[model samples]
Target: MNRRVSELGERGLIRRLREKFPSLHSIGDDCAVLPGIRCPVVTTDSFFEGTHFHRWWAPPQILGRRLLEAALSDIAAMGATAKWFFTALSVDPGIGVNWIEGFYQGLTEREDVILAGGETVRGERLGITLTVIGEGEDRDTILRRSSLHPGDNLWITGLLGRALDAPAKLEKAGGLSGKDLKPRSGFLSSAELEQLRAFLQPRAELELGIKLRKAGIRCAIDISDGLFSEASHLSLESSVDTVLEIDETLFFDSVKDNPLAASAAGEDYVLLFGAPVGLEFSSVGCSKIGRAETGNGEMTIFLDGERVSINAKGYDHLGVRK
Candidate 1:
């Protein structure tokens, strides 16, 4: 037996039902890739003040890029190419038009993504929602979390905790003045600045997703939540057992000391996928982190072959922590 799964007994129960009914595995992941002349995919993502983000955390331009890429990450997970987007903004009276223009500028930076339309309304708090539409590059090989199978090798693009500690690092400085990137500490170290930018300016790895799909990988999930959280979801959705190996080198230098905790920090926005065994992708910047196995939908971490339990905290919109 593998290690005990943390806080997911409900998934275990559901797994039995899925196992009994083998045909129930075709659910979906991330963006909804509906059948059509190019397999149209669509996703909706929303962010609001004091919950998803803070105005002081970054400049409007940076925030716009960050949130857009976050939404586009869903498209990448399904190996789809973004074609268009619609934005809806809810803002307070205190916000200025210049800030809105800057946000729009960052949002429309890419020529590939056209702004179909948007709606703006005045509200007490600032909020932005985006509906991104895309088409699958190849309909047959579109990635989905439910496509993982037992004995599949788990591979991850880039480091697992690239920006894991960035939240505390940025919040330590008390953030900016809701205007500019001026630090209260008078100055920030170059390393800190780089880490802050890592969190704020992440890009959806569209090319990587397409490459993986072409390479015969058909299962993947974006790391918007913690690594373990998403990994658990992949296992549950696929109705298989997963064993994750935590290599110290898999984490960023800042969080390597406590890789278990770091893997739960989220905001990496990288791809974690399942591939066939004997396939090496290190040249393309991917590392095998684990494997799926035959069992109830459960996940475990084995360090040096000994199972360890991890309380991987996923981001929640409300006060609940899952």
Candidate 2:
């Protein structure tokens, strides 16, 4: 027997969903809720085979874990606790049954979160879409992109440029980018190994987000794009001039000299938040890197007291000078 949407209708469909997926609370409301969550925080992301990621980049399980990590970063940015996630996959059977099983196994690595029901279908190429839901204490506890204000200090978690390192090397090895300059070596330094691990498996700042929410941080963003792009976004969002006064200490040892590369390389997945000037967060491993200034949606970068110039991502959309 087969079922049709017209037969069940909307209410009936919701009732079925509630019955089948008992983990979700308060289904059929304007917004569904998770158990014990006060406010719902929802975020969605789409990943395709070639454009966003390449299957050959990592093992199926590692790739699946990384995808979940990337999407969870959004929930972390909202200062919320992720409780559930629904994943939709478009896979070709040629991709193999073991690969699919391994992928799902990887997604279930976190016991705290439940994998809600989702749909899967055959497609020409692989595509994965994830919808993650988290919770905050209340409406006021959720962070906002527009809450950063002038005179607030900008803080970032973890080293920058490491996330882009592994992918760039992988692309070069796959001959997508430029040719690899040097041959692969068996001996790898601890730092070099760390960079590769950072990309293959990145961890979202989940506990940090909860702490930031408890600490009353009103505005924050995860560094998914590049530092430059994220800073421009925050500026446009808050309608303030974002100024990054950076030093080599703010970056990984590899790209410290290249300010433009360090600033533009994305996918760090670290938290960047604005706190009141003079406020310190030394205990939480956060570095005070910049400040939000009074202006209209412009971003400025200063390296060692000298201002550098470059065309940046979302720079034109913000309608600002170089």
What are the RMSD figures for all models against the true structure?
15.0, 7.9
Clashes of 2: 1
lDDT of 2 by residue, 1-322 (tens): 3354335543444455445445433343444444666798999999899877777666667777778989999999999888899877776545655466556666767877787656565677788899998887788878888889999999998788875556566554441211222214334445555565676677899989989888889999999998888888889999999889888887776566665676677888998999997678877899998999999999887767767665634222222333
Q: TM-score of the candidate numbered 2?
A: 0.80
Residues 42-89, model 1: lDDT tens digits: 999999988877776777777887889999999999988888777777
Error of 2 at 71 (Å): 0.6
Q: How many clashes in each structure? A: 0, 1
Could you tell me how far off, in angstroms, the CA of residue 146 lies in candidate 1 after the best superposition?
0.6
Steric clash count of candidate 1:
0
| Residues forming the 10-long window of minimal summed lDDT in candidate 1 | 1-10
TM-score of decoy 1: 0.80
Question: Model 2: residues >4 Å from true position, as ranges?
Answer: 1-37, 171-190, 312-322
